[model samples]
Target: MNELERSVLAKIDQEQLARLCRQLIQAPSENPGGNEESTVLLLQSLLQDLGSTVHLQYAAPGRPNLIAHLGGGNAGGGLLFLGHSDVVPAGSGWDADPFTARREGNRLIGRGATDMKGGLSAVIAAMASVNQHAPHIPLTLICTVDEEANALGIEHYISTAEAAQYLACIVAEPTDLITIIGCRAAANLQVQISGASAHAGRPSDGASAIEAAAELVALIGENKQKLAAAPHPVLGPATWNVGTLKAGHGTSIVPDEAWLGIDRRLLPGEDPQQVLDALLAAARNRIEAAENLDALKLQIRGSVQMFMPGFLTDPEAPLVRQVCTTLQDLGAAGKHGIWTASCEGGFIAEHHNVPTVVLGPGEINTQAHQPNESVSVSDLHTAACAYALIALRQYETSQN
Candidate 1:
């Protein structure tokens, strides 16, 4: 490590880092209502204190995003650190208060602590550390809202011209300190089945929409098996989930309407539209082939409510290499991997063509979206160092 890198690493204050993580977790920026204004203001103040220029942009009335820039004067390209501020709802089964930010030994426990608040705090601390050394490398930090819900904050940011100028992006998602080069795409599918309604006593007079919906659901399950046959080398197979099913109002009446909600995960090369079309066609064919259902006059409609394309960044890319090398220099094993869950990295990579990687602290399987979410304090410290070192190295490379 060079003098600047050493200085930046030394500037990381563990207490301050812990305090920031606690404060953010306590803010309760849950996505259902998307109350991120408080979190945005907190980040704005933190960035300002680090001597960085902070901009607050709103995608909606109560939903805001924070963009902080430092040291862009002499650099031709800058590194962007992207993180989300919103967290999934903290459900029951917590041993302690989900928002209390309890610390036991090396672990800090709370909602959003591992999912991303801890990562976000690490990024903020790293930015502050790098700012102290007065390095010439340009850096941008983006803390977006609604990542747990619709990801509107990032969706809005990437639509602007500023998002296209980044040399690379590091999304601080929970990755257990490994480098994630790709992630699967995701889409929400809604299937509506329509049929005639009648009294429960007259079975032959009315068609049961519930029965037709069940048949369609069975067809979807069969299609899922076909999708699993072809899997991406890194991302694994495309998957489908029937998340929700609703039909019929009462036990006495034959239901006229039914709905099925599905979550479809697409592989890197698969087209989302094609997948939807194929599923619809399968349902249509199955319904037409059914001998008894012809008299029921059943109809099925499929629509995609949301779509996020999958992406893969070459492991040999300059930014990816720098990140891996920096992690190794920081005394951590650097390995390239893929994330099964969806993240903003996919959107950034597909829409802006920016090479993006997911690298941060905490284990996603054990900590993310769980009742008592927590992150290792040691992991947080290492993440701070890694982020700082990567920024410094990227700056040096740009200068050469």
Candidate 2:
């Protein structure tokens, strides 16, 4: 590495990165509680210490988004590093306290350690290093809220002037250092089936909503098989899962109401509205064709609870090429690929038409939302170097 490159990499303090990651993980920003105020404040303070301009924007009460900008002489617009402050709830089943960040060998363990606290901390460290060494590198750091849930923070950001002015964006999602240039869309479906209630002994007196729900589940499974046959080349296939199902309260009574929650993942070029409409139509058709006829007094309804469209950035896009080149320079895999999971990168790419890439430390499978979540410290250092290099490269390119 050249002297300047070595200097940038050297400035990435490993201890500071670990400390910051631990602090972030210790702060609870769980989505269900909608509590990100403390995390937001922590980030704000960190950015302020670096002499960056910080602003707070709220999508809801106690849920605030932080935007920090480091001015530079580059004329090619700004580069945005997008990350979320909010994390999924730390469910039961853990060997240690989920809120306490612990260092076990090379891994730092905590609730948000890998999901993105590590990535976020690395980016912040890189930003600080870049600002000190190369002040001309224009950078924007967007620490958002609600990414684990509805992505309200990102939704609120795209409408701002800062998002519109950015040339490209890098989403600091855990990718195990593999660069992600595209992602599949995601949506949640809620289906409710209602039927007359009756005692279990009177089998002929009332219809069972539980049975109707099973029928709908079977129908969805059949449709899922059909969808699996036609897979997207990059994203694979559209998939659905019955994440939740609820029925009657007691065993002695026939279920009068049932609820099913389905999580559907879609590929690029698929219309979410059309997909929902098709699902509803299919369910209605199946219910109408049932052999029981009108005597059952059954009703079915389905609605979409959430929808996030898929997006793909061209491999040749400036941002993608830059990241791939940086990864290669760092002796890492520079190949561009698609992320099966949904992230805010797609939303930014789709809404702002900005070239975006999801690149960061940690593996999605082993770390995100799982018990004893952690990220490799070595990976964090590598990501810090990559982020600094990318920012410097963008700055140099802008000068030309």
Candidate 3:
């Protein structure tokens, strides 16, 4: 490490930082309640210790977003490091306890290890480190909740008074140490199909909703194949999966209803409304062609559009330049690319005009929401060093 990098890393309290991360992982702030109060308080105290002003804003009752600011002077431009405190639910699989942070060999295992919390921890460490040097640029940390679900906390915060201040924001999402400049949008689609019901023995007596559902699923699959064959260049091609399907209630009766939940990831330039139009058209065609159907009906019941609005900062932008230089200066990973998966940065960028980038430590392929999810200790250390250097470089840029 160079003099600057070494100096920055030297200030990070590694043991204290790691302990905070573990304590948070043990809180089990999974969705439903998704209470981030405890974790937010822990971080709030750390920020206060660094001589920063802290504010805890609750979007809902228990869903709190923490903001802390540190400044040595007027600091011409502002920098916000964003992250979330809530984690996704830890379903069944696990060799070790999911909520209880377990350290073994060289990894820390937990639900949010790779998907987020580990990266969030690094930013906190970086904040503490920068505090020691008395940073010349004003720094703000926005740790929010509900990022794993609907990004309710961030959306609420941005729509309020807090978001108007920041000039630039970096979302600390797990990008495997790469600078994620952009991400494709994620959307939820619900397709409901209708048909008549009758006795199973008299097969010719009624229409089958299950049959229509099967046809719709097949049509969706065919559409996915077409999209794959002609993928988008920048954001990649639009892809989808039918995650949920439900049909009739009984084995002996002809099913009266069916529904499917489709998850679509839209590339940068794709039109979500057009995709819906096509899907409805395809479902109608397939259902009308059924052998003994009186009528085919379909409805686009619900959807959650992914909030990616296509943000790209020039490589020469002062912020981007500082980040690139920081990575190289610290001898950390030098790879840079936009992400294909969506993150909370999408919501923040669209709401507040701040140029947003997702950058952090954990690997993208770490099976984040699965059993025994873990983050490498070495990656965590490297991330702390990199983030600290980025903070320092941004301070230098603002001064110039």
Candidate with top lDDT is: 2
lDDT of 1 by residue, 311-394 (tens): 788889888888888888878898788888888787777665778899988999988998889999888999998998888877
Error of 3 at 200 (Å): 1.4
**How do the candidates rank by lDDT, highest first?**
2, 1, 3
In model 2, pairs of residues that clash are none
Clashes of each: 0, 0, 0
Off by over 4 Å in 1: 73-77, 161-163, 294-296
Better of 1 and 3 by lDDT: 1
Whole-model lDDT, model 2: 0.84
lDDT tens per residue, model 3, 1-400: 4576577688776666667678768767787567778778877887788777888888988888987887655332477788888877888879878988988877888988877888878887887776666566577888888877767787778778544656577888888778777777777677777667789998567778787778877888888888898876656677888998888979889887888877788875666777777788877776677666655333323344434334555555666666666677657656668676777777677766777777887776655777898887777777877777776666565567
> Candidate 1 clashing pairs?
none
What does candidate 2's lDDT look like per residue over 23-50, in tens digits? 9999888887899899899999988998
Quality of model 1 by C-alpha lDDT: 0.83
Q: CA lDDT of each candidate?
A: 0.83, 0.84, 0.74
Q: State, as a TM-score between 0 and 1, how close model 3 is to the true structure.
A: 0.89
Model 2 regions lying over 4 Å from their true place: 73-76, 159-163, 292-296
